[model samples]
Target: MSTPTRKPLDRHALWSLLSEKSDFWTEVNVVGVTGSTNADLAEAARHGAEEGRVLIAEEQSSGRGRLDRRWTSPARAGLTMSFLLRPTAPRETWGTLSLLTAVALEETLKAVCGLSAKLKWPNDVLLDGRKVCGILAQAEGGAVVMGAGLNVSLTEDELPVPEATSLLLAGATALDREVIAAEFLAHVGAVYQSWNERGPASVIERWQRNSATLGRHVAVSFPNGRSLSGRAVGIDADGRLQVAPDGAGAVETVAAGDVVHLRPRD
Candidate 1:
């Protein structure tokens, strides 16, 4: 296999592109490597870091997804980044941050890469039924840090799982990390501003429209060794996954879980 040319992100260039229109993204930090951008941002938020602070890493040594599941990608082969947010909305609506990021990612992929992506409830972004990105949001003090790991130039062998894919693998026209980063941040700022101004309904509507999970049969495994097999009915006001039980039961809302999309006959 031949080695692909992985371009390093130019923070200056990125800031210039973003600063022209985005009043939300105040700072951009690009590092060669880090244990986890999310960890870095979480610590910063606690220390009173301002909102709209973005931290991008070329590679993560200790990155994680929901439930602390390890998330890894080759150096400069993916978009591994996080941004801080402090919303004035009700605290209950804070849980929607990750979902909001997923929606923004879907828009970024479509507008920047020309690839139509779908949201797998909660935090995953899918392209052609394969996961292209994963998002995690952590709350610190009154701020929330949203992190995303997006596969960009990874080959099949570089994938962490068979179900995972990259922009290059997905046939994206644009492989420039700087371009994707700028476009993604812009989308995030715009979507977040809209959500804050118009309320959760704005983001929720977009999520449902681009969702790959809603109306699908799924099995959600919780940490307590219990699972719920149901059809994903909708997302509640708090961003919980509303699942209608298989046989007969109330539509249960799941705040956190491992969701597996089940086959039609399963």
Candidate 2:
């Protein structure tokens, strides 16, 4: 297999770009390697780090996804970033932050790289029905930390799972990490502000507009082996997933679960 050509991002260049383009970012830190950007930011938040602090890692040795699944990628072959925020909104609204980032990333890819990406409700970004990105958000007290891992240049063999894809494999026109990161942060900042002012309605509207999960049959699984099969209808006001249980029932609001889109029966 050929080696990846993308090198570690220069913090100076990234900070300069953020300073000129982003409205909310206060600090940007890039590490060559880390266990998880989310972990780093969570620790910083605990230590009183203010909002708009970002941590990006070239590689994550102990990266994790939703439900504590492992997330790994080759050095400099993916975009791994976490942002710390202190929001004025109620804690319940924090669930929408991951949705906000997914929408922001979709817009960034479309406007920056010309790649068509869609959100697979709750947290995954899909390209041609295969995951290209994953988002995880953790909230504590007034601070909320979000981590996003995007597959950029990973080859087929390097993909951690069969249902995963990278921007390169998805035929993105550009592969500039700086440009991608800058636009994503800028858009996320805008979305965060809008979400704070207008609440999840506007954010949910955009997320639904670009979603591939709604209006489909899905199975929401729990670690305890319990599952619910339903037709995903929408996301509620509190940012919980709304699904109409399989047969004929009321819309059930799911606080947390692993969602899987089921194939249409023949």
Q: Which candidate leads in TM-score?
A: 1
Q: Which lDDT tens digits does candidate 2 get at residues 1-266?
A: 46459877988887888778777999899999999999989988988999999999999999999998999999999899999989888777888888899999999999988988989978999999999999999885579999999999998999999999999888899888988898899999998988988888888888899889999999999778889998999888776788999787888888888999998881
Model 1, 113-222: lDDT tens digits are 99999999889999899999999989898999999999999999999999999999889989889888888899899989988777788788889999999999999999
Please give the range of 10 consecutive residues that has the lowest summed lDDT in model 2. 1-10
| Candidate 1 clashing pairs, residues 3+ apart or interchain | none
Clashing pairs in 2: none
> Please, what is the whole-model Cα lDDT of each candidate in the order they appear?
0.92, 0.90
Q: What is the TM-score of each candidate against the true structure?
A: 0.97, 0.96
lDDT of 2 at 68: 89
